[model samples]
Structures are given as C-alpha cells and as structure tokens.
Target chain A: MAQEFIQWLSHPGLNHFLIISGILFSFGIFAVLTRRNAILVLMGIELILNAANINFIAFSRYGTGTLDGQVIAIFVIILAAAEAAIALAIVLNIYQNFNTVNVDELNQLRD
Target chain B: MDLFTIVFYFLAIITLGAGAVVVFSRNIIHAAFALLFAFFGVAGLYVLLMADFIAITQLMIYVGGILVLVLFGVMLTSQVLDVQMKSGTIQTFPAVLVVSALAGTLVGIFWSTPWKTTAAAPMEVTAAKIGEMLLTSYLLPFEIASVVLLAALIGAALIARREKNA
Candidate 1:
C-alpha cells in the first residue's frame, strides 16, 4: 500500500491537481471564516479564486478537447478582478463609516 | 520517475506550502505577500500542466493586478501607530475542524477516483492559438471583460472620491 501510494504521488495524474485545488479551496475557506480583519477576508477570497483557477487549468490540460476549461478560467479571472474592486470599495467604505475595518465590529445591524 | 511527475510534485509542494502560509499568517500584509507566492506556485503548476495561456494570465492577473489591489487596501487601512491589528483568537476550533475535514474528504476522493490517460498525448497548442480564439470565436466575452474592467475602474474611483467629500 505504501509503495502504491508513492506511485500515485509520483504520477502526474489529474487526481493530484484535483486534490491540491481542493486543499487550497479549503484553506481559503478557513481564512475567510477565521480572519477578523476585512482585508484578510479579501485575501481569503483571492485564495479561493486561485483555487478555482487551478482547477480550470488542470481540467484544460487533461480533459477532453474544445477548450472549455480555458474559457472558464478566463471568466474566473474576470470575475475575480471585479470582485476585488467591489470588495475593496466596500472595505474602504467600512473604514470611513466605522473607523475600523474589523468585520466583527461592522455588525451594527445585528442587534 | 518521469520529468513531468517530478516537476508536478515540486510545484505542488510549493503551492501547498504557500497556501498554508496565506491562511496561517497573522499579519495581513504578510498574508498578502504569501498569497503572491501561492499564485506564483499555481502558475508554475499551470505551466507544468501545459496551459501556458492560463499560466501567463495567472501571473498577470493574480500577481500583478490583485496583489497590488490587496497591498493598496492593506496600506490604506492599516493602523500606522498599531501595526499589529491582526488578532490571535478569532475562529480557532471551528476553522481547524472544518479545514481538516475538507482536506481529508478531498484526499479520500482523489485516492478513490480512477483516472485514465489519453492514448494519444495532447498536442502542443501554442499561446498564439489562444490569442486567435480570443480575437475571433471568443471575441464577445473578451470584449465584455474589457467593459467590465472599465466599469470596475469607474466604480472604484467613485467610492474613493466619495470618501474625500465626506
């Protein structure tokens, strides 16, 4: 079993990419949930975007023809840029209104 | 092992390590820099996977564009007197449990799946072909992305300007 696992490890198989992307996505989720600062949350979102980008590139390389994977990756990049712009604007607004960018402190309407 | 496999493992390790840093770093600026490393590692993986166009786009967008935006946000909002705004205890146990479970499930799924290779290896499709498609068949989406960027630019400027007035 150990030898078989090593073989899989050394294989440039699609499974490796899938697993790596999944791990990255989870780390991003962890960052998003755990981080208090709004900027850190944005970074987490970027990480999540990258994880999706990895999946797209991997699929583009290994999957069937037609270049759909590349197309999807292009869209992901476009969306990420838009998201960053809008999110940063929101963060700046939060700073102006609340005097701090701590996401926890922005719960003014929670009560 | 073959060259491709060797390169894949190396890039994968780098990507994972940088990703871990992005999550675990306490300082927001440090996390942003670590994210740059992670993006570079992912681009490396893209190159290894023969997605040259995607690799270049990753480098251009994630490293060049998004990182700059993140750094600007970090610099603009950071407390100059108290740089250590990154707290220690936010969501500790739940994050650990969730991320660990996610990682385990992904590992299990990867191990269980059976992947088959193509009988004929993928042809060397050049970046020129990608450019050709971008200008031709995918022209609509490409044009749409440009308009979207323009809108984002105007929106960001508006938000920043609103602050100066208020």
Candidate 2:
C-alpha cells in the first residue's frame, strides 16, 4: 500500500490536481469563515476561484481534448478580477465609514 | 521521479504553502505579498496543464493587475502597519471542524470517482481555438462578461470616490 501510494505521488495526474484543488478550496472556506479581516476574506474568495480554475483546466487536459475549459477559465479569471475590484472598493468604503476592516467589529447593523 | 512530476510537485507546494500564509498570516501586508507567490504558482500549474494562454493571462491579470491594486489598497488605508494590521480569527474551532470535514469528503470523492482520462498529448497552441470559440459559440457570455466588468469598474469608482459633502 505504501509503495503504491508513493508511485501514485510520483505520477502527477488528474487525481493529483483534483486533490490539490480540493485542499485549496477547503483552505479558502476556512479563511472565509474564520478570518475577521475583510480583505483576508476576499483573498479566500480568490483562492476558491483559483481552485475552480485548476479543476477546469485539469479536466480539459485529461478528460476532454478541447479548448472549452480554457475559454471558461479565461472568463472565470476576468470575473475574479472584477470581483476583487468591487470587493476592495467596498472594503475601502467600510474602512472609511467605520475606521476598521475587522468583520467582527462591524456590528453596527446589529440590534 | 521524473522532471515533469518534480516540477508539478514543486509548484503545488509553493501554491499551497503561499496560500496557507495568505490565510493565516497576522500581518495583512504580508498576506497580500504572499498572495503574489500563490498566484505565480497557480500560473505555473496552468502552464504544466498545457494551458499556455490561460497561464499567461493568469500571470498578467492576477499578478500584474489585481494584486497590485490590492497592495495599493492596503498601503492607502489608514493604520495598515499598526496594531490593526493583525488579522484575527473568530470561532476557529468550529471553522476548522467544518472545513476539515468538507475537505475529507472531497478527497474521498476524488479518490473514488473513475475520471475519464486520455493519453497525454503534446502541448499545442490553444490561443486561436479559444479566440474562435469566444467570438462564435461563447459570444453571449463573452459580451456579458465585458458588460459585467464595465459595471464593476463604474461601481468601484462610484463607491470609492470621496463624497463632496463630507
């Protein structure tokens, strides 16, 4: 079993990409859930986007020999760029109003 | 053992390690900088997957554009290097528990699923095909994405601009 696992590791395949993307996605979730900084949360979202991109490219390369995945990945990248721009602008607005980027401290909407 | 596998593992480690730093780093500036490496590693992975156009796009757009904007935001904001630079976490235990469970499930699924695999082909130029598809089959989404980007640009400017009454 140990030798088989090592051999699997040595051959980087579709499953390898999938596993890596899964880990990245989980880390992104953890960051979004736990981090108090709004910017950090945005970073987490980027990570998640990247994880999805990896999956798309991997499947396109290993499963289907087409350019559809690459095209979609380009669109995803563009969307991620736009999202980061809007999110950073919003975060800056929040800082201007509340003087802090900590999500926990932005409880003014609370009763 | 092989060079291809070696490069892939190296890039993966860099990506994941930098990603971890981006998540758990206390200093926001450090995290922002660490994100640079993560993006680079991801781009490298894209190249290894034979998506050269996507890889270059990832490097240029992400490393050149978005990351610089993020760094600028960090620098322009008030007290970025002071005590407030420390990014704290809330409900760490519960978050870890949930994330770990989700990760386990995903890994199990990946291992069990019999994915469709084809013989590895030599890297070919994909820019032309991608461009052709964008203009033909994906024309609607392509145009919509541009519209969305325009809206985001205007929205960002509107929101970040200083109010006159203030």
Candidate 3:
C-alpha cells in the first residue's frame, strides 16, 4: 500500500493542480457574486487571475516541452498588475463621486 | 504520500477555504485577510511547481503589495465599525445560482477533457532562460506592459488627487 501510494504521488501530472485551480476559480466567482464591496470584488478578480496563473505554471512545469505556458504566466502576472492599478483607480473615482464603494448603491443604471 | 503531496494538499485546502471566506465574509477587512491567505496558498502552489522565482514574486506582489493596497482602500472608504460592517446584506440567492452554474460548467469541462502530456522532450531550462526570452523575443510586449503600468500610475495619481482649494 505504501509503495502504491508513493508511485501515485510522484505521477508528475497536472491533474491535482488543475483541480485546485478549478476550485479556486469557483470560489472567486462566488466572491464576485456575493460580495457587496467594490474592493472585495477586485479581490475576487485577483483570485480568479491567480487561479489562471496556477494553471499556467502547472502546465509549464509538467509539460515542459514548450516555454509557451511559462511565457504566458509572465504576461499574466504583468497584466494582473496593470489590471489592479486601473481597477483601484476606478474604485477611487467611484468613492470620490459617491462617497461609497458599496456596489448595491450604484444603481443609477438599474432602471 | 511524499512531502510534496502532503504540502500540496495542505496548501490547497487552505487556499480554497480562505477563498470561500473572502467571498462569504461581511466585513471587508476580514475578507481581505482571507484573501491574503488565498494568495499565500497560491505562492505555495508555485513552490510545488518548482517555480521558485515566481513563487517569491507571488508572495511579494500579491500578498504583500496588492493585498495591502486593497486593505488600505477598504479602511479609507468605510465608516462603519467592524460589528456594523459585519451586518451588511450581501445578496445571496442570485449569487449562489450564478456561482453554482459557473462551477458546474468549469468542472464539467475539466473532467471531460483528457489532458495528455505533450510528447515533446522536456527542456532543461531555468528562470534565467525565461528572463532572456523576456528581454529578447518578448521584448516588444514587455516594453508595452511597462508603458501600460506607467500610464496606469499616472492616471491613478491624477484621479486620486482632488483639487483641495476648489
């Protein structure tokens, strides 16, 4: 039993990572849906991005034939930083105009 | 299970649980804390994947920098006490429905696909190789991303600094 389990552990496949990424992605979507704060929404978005990053790095590590996945992960990180900067700016602007970052109150477009 | 598997499972559980709390918590500060845990978990995952450089970057950037920024935003904007913040109504039913559907679709796609490892020979490359690629073949995109960050910083400063005497 020990030997069998050890062999399974060293399989070097991406399935475990994929499953974890999928769960993280789901949790992120849940956060995006239920959270009322704009900043929390941005956190959710970051979680989603991190999930994608995990997938990229996993594929890069396991497949290793091409560097494309690792390259993509680098781009993803840069894009995520850019995204966070713009998002925070927008959040700040929203707070300035309304003095609140609660999503439910921004209902001018809800008619 | 070996050490790697043990660590992977532990980190994975922490990440998923913390992520759930991030969405489910009513107080924004608590949510931010949970997000920090989730980010730390991802960095752990990076270590498991043997991307030590990327793992360190994830820890520094996501947990240290971005999360701090988020917590600052939360503190700057909120007036309620922690107890008051804890009672805010988060719309539930619609959110649950949408999230469940999304999870189902994603898991379905993941399960249906037979993920085959590409038959290409493994490259014995390092983070140095990646750095070289970024500077050479990927230089154009790298430069563009830097420009975008510069623009974002300027824009953020411009939008955030209100005219005080106006």
Candidate 4:
C-alpha cells in the first residue's frame, strides 16, 4: 500500500493538482481566519487565488485541451493584481489613521 | 518515476511548503518573502502543465509586479523590527478545525470524482493562441480588463496618497 501510494505520487495527474490546490486553499483559509494582520490576510487571499488558478489550468490541460481556462486564468491574475493594489492602499490608509494594521482592531464602524 | 514526475513533486513541495510559511509564519516579513517562493513554484507548475503563457505571466506579473507591491506594503507599514512585525494568530482552534474539514472534503471530492481527462495537452507556444482568443472571442472582457485596471490604478493612488487636509 505504501509503495502503491509512492507510485501514485510519481504519476502526476489532474487529481494530484487538485489535491495540492485543495491544500493550498486550506492554508489560505487558515491565514485569513487566524492572522490579525491585514497584510497576512491578503497573502492568504493570494494563496487562495493561486489555488483556484491551479485548478483552472489543470482542468484546461487535462479535460478538454481548450484555451478558455487559460484565458480565464489570465483574467483572474489581472483581477488579483487590481485587488492587491486596492487592498494594500486601504491597509495603508488604515495604518495611517489608527497607527496599527491589526484587522480585528480596526473593526469599529465609524470615528 | 520520470524526470517530469520528479520535477512536479519538487515544485509541489516548494509551493505547499512556502505557502505554509506564508500562512503560519510568526514574522510578517518572513511571510511576505516566503510568498515569493510560493509564487515561483506555482509558475514552475504552470510550465510543467504546458501552460507556457500563463507560467510566464505568473512569473512576470505575480513575482515581478504583485510580490514587489506586497513587499512594499510590508516595509511601509511595519516599523523597525520584532514588536510590530509579529503576526499572531487568533482563534487557532476554530481555524484549524474548519480548514481541516474543508481540505478533507475537497480532497475526497477530487479523488473520488472520475475526471474526464484527455491525453496531456500537446506542448505548444500558447502565447499566440491566447492572444488571438483575447482579441476575437474574449474581446469584451479584454477591453473591460484594461478599464478595470485603470480604475484600480486611480483608486489605489487616490487612497494611498498623503492626506493634505489632515
């Protein structure tokens, strides 16, 4: 059974990519949930995006051999860039105002 | 088993291990830098998967562009070292429990589902094909993406700029 598992590991396939993506997605979720710092949370979000992209590319390559998944992955990358820019800017503003970037502490609705 | 499989395993380990550091590291700077390797591993995997265009894009945009931006965010916000740099986790038990459950379900689904897969995509220069698709079938989204990028650029600048009235 152990040798069979190793054999399975060596033969890379759709399921392998999916499992890795799943693990990465879980890591992102853990970061998003646990980290008090907004930047760390953003990093987790980036991980999640990467995980999703892996799935897309994997499906694109393995499933239909279509370029649509690759195209959509490109779009997703663009969106992630925009999101990072905007989110970091907001985090900076939050830091400037509150003197801290701890996400939970920035929870009050208004001044 | 083969050279390809070996490379895939190496890339997967780098991706997941670096990703773990990014998520679980106590130091925010460590997390930020660890993200660089995670991005690099993903790019390598894209290459292995024959998505050459996406792999290069991942390297250029993710490694060159976004990672730099994230590092800048880290440098600008955190002062000096040690005290403010520590990124502590909150509600650890719940996070672990929830994440483990989610991951287990995803893995179960991925393995159990008999995916419809053809032979691996023929290794080809995908940049030209992707470009043609972008211009033809994906034209609307292509144009809209540019617009969205413009808006984001302006918005980010507006938000991050020093407040003169303060």
Interface RMSD, one decimal, each candidate: 1.9, 1.2, 2.5, 0.9
Compare the candidates by DockQ and give the number of the best one.
4
| lDDT digits (tens) for residues A1-111 of candidate 2 | 999999888999999999989998998999999998888888899999999999999999998978888999999999999999998998888777777778898988422
Model 4 Cα lDDT, one tens digit per residue, A4-42: 988887799999999999999999999999999999999
List model 1 lDDT by residue over A19-107, tens digit each.
88999898888888988888888888888888888777676667664466777788888889888988898788778767788877787
Give Cα-based local distance difference scores for all models. 0.81, 0.90, 0.78, 0.93
Error of 2 at B74 (Å): 1.8
| lDDT string, candidate 4, B60-148, tens digits | 99999999999998988888554767877899999899999999999999988999899985689999999999999999999999999
- Cα deviation of B147 in candidate 4 (Å)? 0.5
Q: Candidate 3 falls in which docking quality class? A: medium
Error of 3 at A46 (Å): 0.5
Better of 1 and 3 by lDDT: 1
DockQ ranking from best candidate downward = 4, 2, 1, 3
The best-first sequence of candidates by lDDT reads 4, 2, 1, 3
Q: In model 4, which residue pairs have backbone atoms overlapping below 3 Å? A: none
Overall local distance difference test of candidate 2: 0.90
- Model 4 fnat value: 0.91
**Native A-B contact fraction in model 2:** 0.80
Q: What digit string (tens of lDDT, one per residue) describes model 2 on residues B96-132?
A: 8999999999999987799989987888998998999
Task: Summarize candidate 1's per-residue lDDT along B17-36 as a digit string, tens digits.
Answer: 98888789887767788888
Of the two candidates 3 and 4, the one with more favorable TM-score, higher being better, is 4
